[model samples]
Target: MNKCIFFFLSLYLLCFQSFAQTSSVKTVPNADLVYEKTKLGEQVNSPYYEGQPVVSADGKFLFVYRVGHPDNVGYKTYKKDEDIWVGERMADGSFSTMRNVGAPLNTATNNAVLGISGDGNTLFLYDQYNLSADYAVTNIAVSERTTDGWGKPQSIKIKGFRWVSEPAYMNMSVDKRILLISYANNRVTFGKQDLYVSFLEADGTFSEPLNLGKDINTAGIEASPFLAADNVTLYFSTDGRAGYGNLDVFVTKRLDDTWQKWSEPLNLGAKVNTPFWDCEFSMTAKGDVAYFTSGGQNYGENADVYQVKIKEVARPEPVAMIYGKVLNKNTNEPIATKISYTNIKTHQNAGLASSNPKDGTYKIYLPKDKAYSFFAEKDGFFAIKENIDLTGLKTYTEIERNIYLVPIETGVAIELSHLYFMQSQPTLLPSSEDELEQLFDILQKYPTMQIEIAGHTDGVGNKQKNQMLSVQRANAVKDYLVKKGITAERIKTVGYGGSRPIASNEKEETRKLNRRVEFKVLSK
Candidate 1:
């Protein structure tokens, strides 16, 4: 009985230890599984092909299509009665209750459902028409949701570039003002069926159209664009870009306002592509779910809709932290301080909890790819300024530094790689005086800046004697700065003894590093 109890206890302890080692992770849903159309409503007409379904903001209604051709341009034998369909998902999970919307919204034209905004206030539809060459010409139209019903459709126009063919298959920006349009068989030299964007002005007119440029548009055909709700990411289809086969859905993202620095286009991969054409891509508002048409085995008939999950490219988590303790130069103890960070790009401010009173350590979370202006201020201590430039950092980093507040001193200790001090000694010696002259030049430039002359000794000999020797060494430096024409009023002297060392006194090199004077900036 005793052996069994011990065995179970050991097993429980091992399990608990394993659980403690693993951190909880947030789960993200697959982007493609959000929407799929399986069957037609019983009340709806025969043999319905209900794909390109966009859900309303409340997730109740789905706006889709029933037929592909209305003008009978390509399908000459099929009926030319293309209609936009609407189905509301009842509370009990059945969509047999589908209804056709009223006039001025769905016409006899080839009106294909594009997308709906999250607020349910705007609906985008693509109207396909026949051109002079018997090819299809597609234009985009938007309808505003009025109190009673949708307003009359307004044709979208983009300036500059003329050949805007397929607007219905494009995605809109977050504000629903900017639209991404695709052109097919147009004489665009860069890529076939390239995508373009046009911004809607305040007067309901669109601005000049601009090509999606090199990162997104490839040499081959690229169409069927979808913008995530964030408005910075774009997902589209292209056969020219790197993919598993024929045409594949790809995604790119905008960094800041610059579209040129977009992420490389990612192929939706084998699950979303097939041997034949797999283009026309659409996604949910959150961007986790993507749906496209494929002539694969899962589809019962020709070119059925298939869904696949997509993940946004993972960005490196920012983990670089600057942690340091501010200490009083005289007492060698921590001090409470206030800190602020100025963003270098936007000149914005960020910080947390000021500086903790219990400990002088301030931990600032630094971004992986941006510079920051770090400022720390306390009532008596002079303000501290540090320009942290992280323009090209890739991985997580950590740094520890100790800030010494110079007592009102004429000379301050500045950390320099070449400066060296003898163990438990405060003498300037023969080697370091040349570097100290550079300090004299710095003090002359900042005339108003006061400083505290600090002296330190390695963890050796009597602590009290080391402290006294450090004071004498600091006085010696003050005399030098004053002789160099620095104002005597700006000078203060403080001796830290062996109590405060920049590095551990374990090695001879560290001991040499510890025994030194730092010309700390007092005020400027």
Candidate 2:
């Protein structure tokens, strides 16, 4: 009778704890639940003790905090409050032998599983904080893994907020410009706890904390927020709504350009949640497998880590490519120069690369759907900056761009022909602006071209004075080109004090024709 009762209880627990292997939701028809838990073995026994699992952006490896002793420790000193182990799961679903990540990643001190970085190199853990057990400080620490092993654990201090029990999670935006961190604010414990986000600077420093506001945050406790690789979708744990128990995992997606217009949170449903604590859930970039913490039923003691198949959802893919070129202005010659791309929205630097001198072309791979700023620079030329606001265009789109460089000459004589300026005024006429606009457009279309901006005079006034005026007039033309988004470095201006004339300066009509500004394509 006793054996039968034990058997019945075991079966009931197994049936209730079983992970769903498939999802009928077609939001992500192409993706299926790819990883699942197995019975722990000597290495990783059945119903493997797993929790706080994080997969790489490519779904290649898994990082998790596991606890157990396989090396015959006599079970006496192998207490449940022992060391936290870090395990790596390979593509074959076989986890590398659970290795103590060691101090500072895993200290002799008790640590709670927190979060993992997008690159899978950084890990966040907090000191155990159960007041009843005498562990009550909210100690937060982060460890970075070098090529060798994990580095020393460094603690992060949050100002004005005490009891920083939960370090929450951090991730990249769709464009990878900004780093979003979600943490439970114990600042006001009585009111529902709040979640805050802080930006990561180019130098790896975090900016001032910004409250996510009351929209996504509620007066109820909110914690364990995980940012999807796309950066726009956020998953967090809250007790505001009904679940299997006290806390359930809910997700909120960034809705509009407005920072606060987040969509309402959606419950992950009953199967994944139990009438017990289910929080700190995490998902990979592929949105396939999910990991969380649970204590009741099958899990031996305390909060043990749990894994299950998440319904494949339509999440954004942040990997993509962008390409273009740089060139000379005068002869349309391709100039080999350096160019840099920056993700303004996410604050990510794509690094600097050179355009091919032979063909004046370049290509850059972007993590799709991120806005960027492209800047090109060369000696003796004005730097050019182009702002690309790729709000939602993350597909494999090919962008073709070019740049022009001006000459170094002081002055060159040229016939205006029909190049008419506002009579005697340096202001270019509407028709003249149109002509220059067309030339600028061509330069943009073909990035390897170079050109010279020349000014001429009809010798009607003081030669010296006319020369200076013509120079100014040519500079005005250059400024106009700059306003049209052309690189000023690609436009060299010079005035010929009526020194050289294509048309005879004998008649007012000929002199009128002599006074003008013209561009010559030096290379194509």
Q: Work out the TM-score per prediction.
A: 0.46, 0.51
Runs of candidate 1 with Cα error greater than 4 angstroms are: 1-46, 57-59, 68-80, 90-98, 127-139, 161-168, 184-188, 296-301, 309-524
Q: RMSD in Å for candidate 2, one decimal? A: 12.7
lDDT of 2 at 384: 40
Report the C-alpha lDDT of model 2 over 91-183, residue by residue, as the tens digit.
Answer: 676566666555555443444445554334455556432223545453346665554666666765433434434335543332323444455
Error of 1 at 332 (Å): 62
Q: Write down the worst ten-residue block by lDDT for model 2.
A: 20-29
Per-residue alpha-carbon lDDT of model 1 for 358-441, expressed as tens digits?
A: 566555555556776565555434433455777786554666755555344434445433344454455555444444655676
Q: For each candidate, what is the lDDT? A: 0.59, 0.56
lDDT at 334, model 2: 73
Top candidate on lDDT is: 1
